[model samples]
Target: MSEVIIRDDLEAMAESGLLSDYNRRRLTAARPTDGAMLALNINLTAICNLGCTYCFAKGGDYGRITGKLNEGADVESILQFVKQNAARGETVRFEFFGGEPMINFSTIEALCWRSEALGAEQGIRFLYRISTNLTMRLTERELELFARFRFTVSVSIDGSEATHDRNRPNKAGRGSFRAILDNCYKVRERSDDITLVARMTYVPHPDSSLVADVEALYAFNIFDWFQILPATVSRELVRTVFADAFGDLAYSEICRLCADKVDSEYKLLGEIYMLLFRPGNRFRGVLEIETVIRMLLEGEVANGHCSGGRNYFTFSPDHSIMPCHRLVGEAEFRVGAFGGTIDGEAVAPWRLGINDTPVCRDCAIRYICGGGCKQENFVATADINRPDPEKCRFQFRLVHCAIQAIAESDAAFRARRRGVLRDLFVSCGRPTLSSGRSEEVPAPDRLTHLIPLLHAFD
Candidate 1:
């Protein structure tokens, strides 16, 4: 067994001020960023087959009436939107999203084919991505299309069979875990080219074990990557659970409780340590950890929490445009509409760099943490510019782990693993280097600053 980083180690580092010093240096070195638009998130449908209790989308319609994209009219408008927004000769990604995107399979099919033709004509290269529950059956044609386009398929399966079934059941109240697992096998069998990512939502329940859940998913040996997110309960559910409290108070209380539970339950540092150093382990990289690792390895600083309104925009079924997918139903976040002008003023705040925010300005890990998620910040603090303290604590811990992982790993291990990460980034068409220059892995001696703060995993 590999050495694990315990909570005491983190506490020790904090007490010694090593973490603070490191963050200060990083923050001082941070640069301003103005992100370019590169991807379009198309909400194919606001309908899902599964009835997840904690769905942010309110059972797929974002609390509105259910609807899907119009294959003809909507497709054409989206293509036009892409042509207008995307630069010529640029490689842009079209992300298919929904309550269950496959519900509008024909729309997705039409969009892909038409977008390819449009891309060819306009000198813009197109990439494809989809986030699905994977409960619906896929046809051979669909599989072939995905393989041909080299689609990045994000499968939403909430870890263990019992946990997943309990959280995400079909409308008919039947478990969908078996169906999803079978479909995963079929997807893998169909093509090795398609990037399969297991996206797990960790709901803090008595039966749910974060470590065991991750282990169960890894046991499958099918996913190329894993993305684990803590469940954010819907406002309606929070109201129901806290019947006495009125609107805003209920929301605030729930956010606080959820954040506290997530922080307590997510033993990220130890989990990452084990995954990286565990001997003979079938460890598929977790997206969150890998992102921080990449940032550390490349000495990259984040411009913002995410591209969102700056470089990324989500198109709704009714032609509404949102800065972030999570902000789909929010009227305040509606930047513009398709076939209309995008409000530059509305997007300007989201475009601000991490250091630009007053709350994040003095933060040590502002450059690395990206000020946390804007929508999450808004949900917690009612201000996009202000970050939630609980989330900040979580991000700080994650960054600390990444630093230790890098500082402790031997040169040979890092070199071997570097290529794996590089290939993953390249496959996704994301920038391998945030500095926009040659990436140089800092020598062990150069990382001596962090070495003392980190416990060796041997």
Candidate 2:
């Protein structure tokens, strides 16, 4: 198991302004659902070129709907929905999704332009994002659009060739690792400012460990940000639907592996940045703990994981709407349909906050955790309204590991060992000064130049 140094002085550190109210408030205040719809995920198509074993959508599988799209009225309705939400003074983000989103590139190009024009006229900011397998070659025009629009692209690739190709293969059953890596390089070459996040779905193969998987991502060298999700498949679903591919890999088994190795994962992350020359890029495997500490410092409580229907919703290619991208397929989960009326009754159940969940009401760390992910709840309990015990343990472990990091960082900063604090805070995009100023310290480049003497301590 990985180890994170835990200090018992978090309360004292908070009192000493090691945690600033200004920074904490600034973070928690930017809640996705402050007033209106925060994000809309538009699935342009269900047909992906690569067939990943853990795909929640079952992209190429015949059992699920694929290659569907919104026609004239449905398209108009989606646009109107965004415009209406933006009119309410909310900054709305539109995410492009797919079996592979690039498969429907033409539609995405058109939609991006349309959204930008609307945002310009209405004084609304439009943020664009895409989650793709990155197997196709990107055109010059596509790269130019990404640069011009400041797109945040999340490329889904598992770590290492053997591990990645075993789970994620193209329709022809060949490895996609090479093409995806090449595309990532092309993206970096095209734009330096664009945020490239590498998202990995970890499968507990008999030969690999989580630490090794994370190291594989770092070896790629292009991704500045990373998101890691354990491959989650319900026991019944695996047996009935994807028996050949997933076999007996259960979500609980995955959770147990992670819980046992939490400390090992923590230590790896603490030392990970030392392996690279650059100081800016970050791995977010358990990065949410920083946010949890910020929320704790501010003395605030939050709803469960996501506000779902209230803050964000997914508009599928067929014009059906669900709470999020993860809940795309089930008919019972559909809350509304574009070009049609929204059923408030259907959405009401989803809007239930973390406070509404019975189990979470008494939990000590509910403020940081919210409840658990809604999709995982549905998978474990067979009821979207219920919380999953397996996922609860996983979420709790993340919060616990995060608390450990905060304690260590704060203790080190007060002891004049700000170098370690600087490294940890670099991932947060800004460093909290031990000098107790409400304002943030300067950028890493500016601070690094001023701190040549600090390296003597190192």
Candidate 3:
């Protein structure tokens, strides 16, 4: 078994900007994001077959608040919107979202077919992504089309059979893991879709085992890309919806769970990377620590948490627009309608970066976190500017772990680390670096206040 390795030289790396570069680049990416509207989300339908207990959209069970799109008018309007934006030479990205996007397969197909032809004719490039539960039976034709279009499909499945079944059961209260796995096999057989990402939502409980859960997820081997999200629950709605699933844990406890889970995973992967000399392992979780590694490796920085209401936004079934699909029907978030005139000014408040927020500006991890998630903040504190203390602290611990993993390695590995940091410095337009070492930033202590863990394999 591998053990956690803490390095004494962590503060030196933090000072030289090698450790701090991750957050600095993230903050830089968040600000002055170049280009207009790079990505757009199309919520195909408000219906889902598998009713996940942690679903924010409530499985789209509600009525017209989950609007039904008029196929003819809605598809046309969405295409026009894309064409208008694509004219500016930006490679437009369209994300098909859901209650299970496959439920509205016809709409997705039509939109893709038309958009592909239009993009080809107009000399505008396009990329398509879809988020699905992978429970709906997929046809060979659908797989073929997805492969041909090169869709970056994201399948939602939590950890193992028992864990997944408990939270993401179908309407009949049966586990959907087997069915999803079978479908995934089919998807693999049909095509080599390069970007297959597995999205896991970590709903922490007293019984939760972060190690076991990740081990279960990695067993399949079908997914090389992964992202784990901590469940964001509203306090008022917790009593009505998440009481049984989450137990009596507070939001801070949930954040602590997320922090520990991330630390464990990072250490596990770091051990693997160190043993094999494989830097590719660093890309395992693109949306989490892996993203920081990638940004450093490839020399990229990003603005705040999300580009919602900024360079990208979501389009609901009825053409209503919001910052992102996660905030679909939120009243405060609904900036305008796609078919109608959208008030750009209404979205300006949401586009505020880390520099704009008074609380975030003073945070050590502000640049690294890009002010955290606006939707999560809004749900937790009823204010997007109010940073979640738990998440903020979690980021500090993660960065600390990542820095230690790199800084404490042997002298031979320093060459590889220097190459990545040198590229990062150049990419962000910073002065070329002589080496990766920098002035020391104090290493945050391991989060000892974490909730107790049950034996993972038990």
Candidate 4:
């Protein structure tokens, strides 16, 4: 079993300051209800300026932007989808995704205003969020709108100037760190209280500089939290650069090494525990904890093919619905279109385990791994009916390592505390040598209270 160090101090650490007053109020008012929790992923736009190699959306010239596909989704379609989602009494969270949501700032702003109006009339609490690549083009007003709506803005950068530029370079093939930093500084200069999440991808590397990179992000004082992801690509998704551009092993080790170094970092520790214990926590909700942590920190918790049974529904630019982001554009994976009424029945087939295939069925870690990446199946294998072995092996190893670490932490606490207490309790029975009526010495067997913590600790 791989060793994991889960500190005892974490449970007592302070709560996240990044958690908004609105969220606190919402969490306070409506606890985790069995009532539906729906996240409407509006791929508002697919046009982006940066030219990162592993962009899943194939960003920029390859796709559309804002509330519509290249065909454009009308206000009616978006409204209709929102209404149907609301009719179900779900806790609706609206998330803007794209090549760059800032590109479609007007649509996003309008949607917020419209959603506020409609939700107020309907009495639904509409929460907003967006995932973006921070760029200079975003206006001050747009940043204010995000703050006003409590829309958590999650931005991206690779890591440091060299690292970030090497992987997430611009179209001119130049490092974007300087431009990204300028944007980050502008946000902070405008609003110190604004909650910013910085997302960085983990590319394979021998020397782990992530801890240092995190410190540097801290130095800039822009990001409130840091998000890490293993830059993902599927050879089958697109033939152009998949084989030549997708290999990065250091990202995986960065995560493993990060677990070791950040064990005591107060904020990440809470996320780690949530990823470990809570099924619904944003960090663990992706079905695979490690992968989801990166996504959660990036403010995109994908209720993938694995979590479709849980509580989520995704809408592409066209408002055609799917189980998760990865299923977009793939005809067979579409649960149902948002063009008409959203029939609960039409979307039922994509629920967890329903689409699970042969490799998953035989694998021991299927449930924890959720039969591996659904995106991989779509882009890597070209078959929703199959599980990608590489994906499965990766997740299985990660989950197994996570579980083992949890167990070892459990074992260490017990073994040490038990030994200490056992000695203390046993010493209480160490009678004087002169008082030797030495009863039938109930042997060293009856020390019950001393080891009682074994139950709860384990």
* TM-score for all models, in order of appearance: 0.82, 0.76, 0.77, 0.62
Task: Give the lDDT of residue 81 in candidate 4.
Answer: 72
Superposed by TM-score, candidate 1 places the C-alpha of residue 97 at a distance from the truth, in angstroms, of 0.7
Candidate 4 accuracy as TM-score: 0.62
Per lDDT, the best of the predicted structures is 1
Error of 4 at 309 (Å): 8.2
lDDT of candidate 1 over 135-247, digit per residue (tens) = 98878977998898888888999889988887788888898999999989888888888888888888766335777777787787788787777776656665432334344
Between candidates 2 and 3, the one scoring higher on TM-score is 3
- Comparing 2 with 4 on lDDT, the higher-scoring candidate is 2
Off by over 4 Å in 3: 1-32, 35-37, 61-64, 236-286, 297-299, 404-458
Worst 10 residues of 1 by lDDT: 424-433
Whole-model alpha-carbon lDDT for candidate 3: 0.61
The lDDT ranking, best first, is: 1, 3, 2, 4
What lDDT score goes with residue 125 in model 3?
Answer: 75
Considering summed lDDT, which 10 consecutive residues are worst modelled in model 4? 427-436
Give lDDT tens digits, candidate 3, residues 271-378. 544443345442343245444443333333345566666656677876688776777776767877876655778777766766668788777545445576776777
Clashes of each: 0, 7, 12, 12
Q: Which stretches of candidate 4 lie over 4 Å from their true place?
A: 1-36, 61-73, 87-89, 189-193, 205-221, 236-311, 343-349, 354-357, 361-367, 397-458
TM-score of 1: 0.82
